[model samples]
Target: MNDFLELVKSRQSDRTYDTTRAVEPEKLERILEAARLAPSACNAQPWKFVVVTDKELSNKVGKATSGLGMNKFAKDAPVHILVVEESANITSLLGGKVKNKHFPLIDLGIAAAHITLAAESEGLGSCILGWFDEKEIKSLTGIPASKRLVLVITIGYSAKAKRQKMRKEKAKVISYNKY
Candidate 1:
């Protein structure tokens, strides 16, 4: 596989993280920079990323990501990145309303993807978590009520070995010209 394809294939969701291992500052900065450079609709860039490294705060944020045994591994992650959704620019907002689309949400997703890819390139493990207690997380992070918490990314060293990735054949997922 080509270098880009290999990098994409190697990236995976890692829930089991090495609690003793901490992410390097330079690596985290690069990941954040990648996310910042992600493209947004009309370049509105309606997003904010809050990085949580404090152990106590991380535990609280992790608790918000956990319930019913889901995302239990988040509690052990050394870094948590909160992707907060902000309102888009006037043009993007009007375009979204007129076109019946939520551009900010799409922009946030793109940014999150950039974050994960950058983390993988840095040799760190990451998991994009959407299931979380928004209220609890907001209280812990002091995020404004106006901003919506879109995604929480857990970053750390992988404690578990990589498993082979499973995917449908390209023929099943892609089509040429017409559907």
Candidate 2:
């Protein structure tokens, strides 16, 4: 497989992370760099990332991310990245209104994809978590009340082994010119 294709194939949501292992600073930097380069609507770049490395804080954020048994594995990860949604630039905002879509959310998703791929490339495990207490996380992270808390990505070395990828048949999901 091509390098990028191989990376994509290998990447999966890692729920079991080794608590003893710490991600290297250099690798973390590269992952963040990849996220920073993610494409955004009209280059508006309406996202802010908060990386939590402190054990206590990571635990707090992780616990907050887990609501009603959801994302219970997050507390074990060594790092948690908060993807905050910021105001888009004027052009992107206008385009979003005209297109009847919120471009910032799309932009944030793209950024999160980049981050997960990069973490995989760096031999780190990652899981993008959305089932979190938005208001609690915002307060815990000291994120401005006006900003949107979009995603929380847990990262660390995997304690569990990689499993085979399961998916629908390509033919079933793909289409020709018309759906």
Clashing pairs in 2: none
RMSD after CA superposition, every candidate? 1.0, 0.9
TM-score of each: 0.97, 0.98
Report the CA-based lDDT of candidate 2 relative to the real structure: 0.94
| Runs of candidate 2 exceeding 4 Å displacement | none
lDDT of each: 0.94, 0.94
- RMSD (CA, Å), candidate 2 to true, equals 0.9
The sequence of per-residue lDDT tens digits that candidate 1 reaches over residues 1-179 is 49778889999999999988889999999999999999999999999999999988998899899998899989899999999998799999999999999999999999999999999989999999999999999989999987899999999999988889999999999999988
Cα shift from native, residue 73, model 1 (Å): 0.4
Residue 93 alpha-carbon offset, candidate 1, angstroms: 0.8
User: Candidate 2, after superposition: displacement of residue 125 in Å?
Assistant: 0.6
